[model samples]
Target: METTEKSVVRRFYDIVGSGRPEDLDEICSPGLVGHAGAGSNLAELKASIGSFLEPFPDLTADVRYLVQEDDLISSWVSFTATHEADFAGVPASGRRVKFAEWDLFRIRDGKIVEITQYCDLFTIMSQIGALPTAAPA
Candidate 1:
């Protein structure tokens, strides 16, 4: 059961990172909801992901860990991308950036029904020059 849950979560990331939006329906429920720092629903989540993918065409998420308990899966992921287009009103910086995030997913009937994410948004903004960088020591 744990292995199945972990595999579902892993496949979710794999399909997402592969830029295969069409495959989302197969893994995610129609009523999928995202909480915390992510979107609110499946459409919103897809749009958010699309926005990121637009700027970072090669965006990829590396799963540091995936732990499952019953219907819930917790994941630690590191994302890496090269800024090649505008993002969140910031022009392309042509820089490679990496960020880490923690996510919790709820799955039922072999589909992801809910998710919550915690990510370093400030660091991402700083990396993209949207936020001021720290002064040298």
Candidate 2:
């Protein structure tokens, strides 16, 4: 059970990081849902991933930690990407940005059923020059 759960989670990252968003159907259930401060179903989640990838064509996620228990997997991921196109209304800065996220997934029957993600958006915005920087000491 643990191995299967872990494998499902790993495969999700592999598919997304590999820029094969079209293959998400292989890992995610038709009823898969996402709860990341907002609710999103499978279709919306796929579209969101597409939008993100559009801006960072070279985006990559490095899983720093992954733990599983009772069909639930928790992952701490660090993502790095070069800002080459407009993202969320912010124009491209041609700068590389890194951000961290802690994500939780629930899997059933070898398919991801639900996901909850917590990310450091403020830091990412600051890195992309969207947010103001701290004052120098």
Candidate 3:
């Protein structure tokens, strides 16, 4: 049971990194609840992912850990991508950035029903020069 649940979460990241957000329907439920303001439906989720992928076309997710407890899986992941296009109104800086994200997925049957993500936006923005970084003393 745990293995199956973890596998679903693994596929989620794999599909996202593959630059095919539409394929996520295979692993995600139709009524999935997502974090970071992603839409509650699969179609909306795909659109949201597509928008993000448009800017960072080469985004890749590296899974650091996948821990399972019953039907829920917690994943610690690092994503690396180059800012090749405008994102969130910020022009592309051609910077490569890596940021960590802690995500929780609830699996049912064989599909992910919900996802909660905690991302390191400060580090990502700082790396892309969208936010000012403090100098080391």
TM-score versus the correct structure, for each prediction: 0.91, 0.91, 0.91
- The C-alpha lDDT values of all candidates are 0.86, 0.85, 0.87
Cα lDDT tens digits for candidate 1, 41-135:
98887877777788888879999999888899999999998989998888999998999989999999898999998987777788999986777
Clash pairs detected, candidate 2: none
- How large is the C-alpha RMSD of every model relative to the true structure? 1.8, 1.9, 2.1
Query: Taking the tens digit of each residue's C-alpha lDDT, what string does model 2 give over 1-137?
Result: 44988888889888878877779899999998899831487877777777778888888989898898898999998999898899879999998999998889999999999998787878778999998798878
- Model 2 lDDT on a 0 to 1 scale: 0.85
Task: Report the Cα lDDT for residue 76, model 1.
Answer: 97
Minimal lDDT window, size 10, model 2: 37-46
Sorted on lDDT, highest at the top, how do the candidates line up?
Answer: 3, 1, 2
Model 3 C-alpha lDDT per residue in residues 44-67, reported as the tens digit of each score: 779988998988899999999999
Q: Model 3: runs farther than 4 Å from truth? A: 135-137
Scored against the true structure, residue 26 in model 3 reaches a CA lDDT of: 95
